[model samples]
Target: MNKLKFFVAALLMIVAGTASAQKTGYISVEQVISLMPETTRIDSLLRKYQSDSLNPQFTYMVQEYNRKDSMVSTKDSVKLSAQVKNQIRQELEGYAYQIQNWQQITQQALQGKQQELLEPIYRKVEAAIQGTAKENGYAYVLNREALIVVPPADDLLPLVAKKLNLKVPAAGAPAAAAAPRR
Candidate 1:
């Protein structure tokens, strides 16, 4: 029984050592995504949409709110009846609230459009990562941003790029910015 127990313990140690030897790599997913060509097109679309549609609406709302605010602020309350003053106050408040809400809604809509446009690009990158991992015998491919410390030469960006048939751009290539979320 002691001999069998000793053999089992030895086998476990060997298995553990082998498992720990598996290849692991990290990649900056944000950087990789930003480098994708589709990102530029998506950014262009987002900018155009903001300038053409959302901005005009936002500007109109701001102008309307400003006009109402000016009227409310400049009006002589002593000359106005109580009912008229109250109505003007409520109108000003309504315009202010709508302007605030419109800004929030427009921001959210833009973010949604950005994510929608990038979904396919993200999927392609993901597929390339998985293919590279499988071909390279990597046991783990972690996101660099999530790691406390990443060893040099452990980044899989070039490897994944090769798998995707993409040319690795210069180190200082422009990064794509995500939509504003605040």
Candidate 2:
């Protein structure tokens, strides 16, 4: 009976020790990315891509649509064959459809451009987070936004930011506000 009791105590102690050794931490990855200097450059590049590439394409599409519309409207329909008129009408409809959906199209283009530009920055931040976790003995790192209540010292933002050579905002400051809107 004494041996049984000793064995049970040993098993409980081992379980407690294993549980205590596992460390978990939390960080706001968006906050870290916002603090990164690369993010500002990415924002600038996206703006430039919009103005330089997307805006001109939109303008050209509108101009082409208007020109086609004007040509169809001014031409004499009585002199034209039914087949020719139908073809022109179909073409005009296509243009109108593109113009109507331009916002969604442009939004998708901008999102793709932003993703391309941000990919490397994301990789860098991920590496820093992984390295920090490994160096600091964190078994799991949770997104800070996912947690309702967290232990103060277990916040890994400062450590991760430091690992990335970025400055963290002072306590009580809204770090999320610095993040760029997607």
Candidate 3:
């Protein structure tokens, strides 16, 4: 009974100490990358990839081919028209498939590259954040980005940057968009 009472007293003291400790700051994963130079480059590269005029050109070519195909089929060019129409249809479908595959490949490439580029830096930042919290006697250092209901005053992006020795980018920094294969 005496040992049980002692353990209970110790546990209560520990909880009380924890409850009274101070907490440091928070930042979002998005904000973290925005501050990094590599992320900016990645954004720029992807934008150029997705904006080529291939779609419009493909549509125009397909339409022109179909019109000629109908004309040739209507008179005495039946066999040739069938071959031309089939070829045009195949080309149009091929372009569509290429677009779908490009989208998937681009997404995968960016994700993999981003993870590779950011892993070491993220680890360093995480360690620095924990050290800051412990040194400052913070009871809980929460990620406001992960939480839906952080108080506005508790948004700690600036504090986290300061502690981690990282600079936040100025407003309107352009992100890179890599060009996808045509």
After superposition of all CA atoms, the RMSD between model 2 and the true structure is 3.0
Cα lDDT for residue 151, model 1? 82
Residue lDDT tens for model 2, 99-169: 89999998999888888877788788888989999999998999988999999999998898888888887
- Mind giving the per-residue lDDT tens digits that candidate 3 earns over 1-182? 99999999999999988776655456564565456555566555455433444345445555665665465556555546667767756765665565557657556655665565566667766776676667666657776546877765655566667776668555486533322211
lDDT at position 47, candidate 3: 50
Query: Could you give candidate 1's per-residue lDDT for residues 1-182 as a string of tens digits?
Result: 99999999999999999999889999877767766777778888999999999889888878877875666567454677778778877987886787779868887889988888888877888888988888888989998878997887878999987776667776787545642221
Off by over 4 Å in 2: 1-16, 76-81, 173-177
- For model 1, where is the 10-residue window of minimal lDDT? 173-182
Candidates by lDDT, descending order = 2, 1, 3
TM-score of 3: 0.49
Q: Which candidate is the best by lDDT?
A: 2
The lDDT per prediction is: 0.80, 0.85, 0.60
For candidate 2, give the lDDT of residue 76. Answer: 62
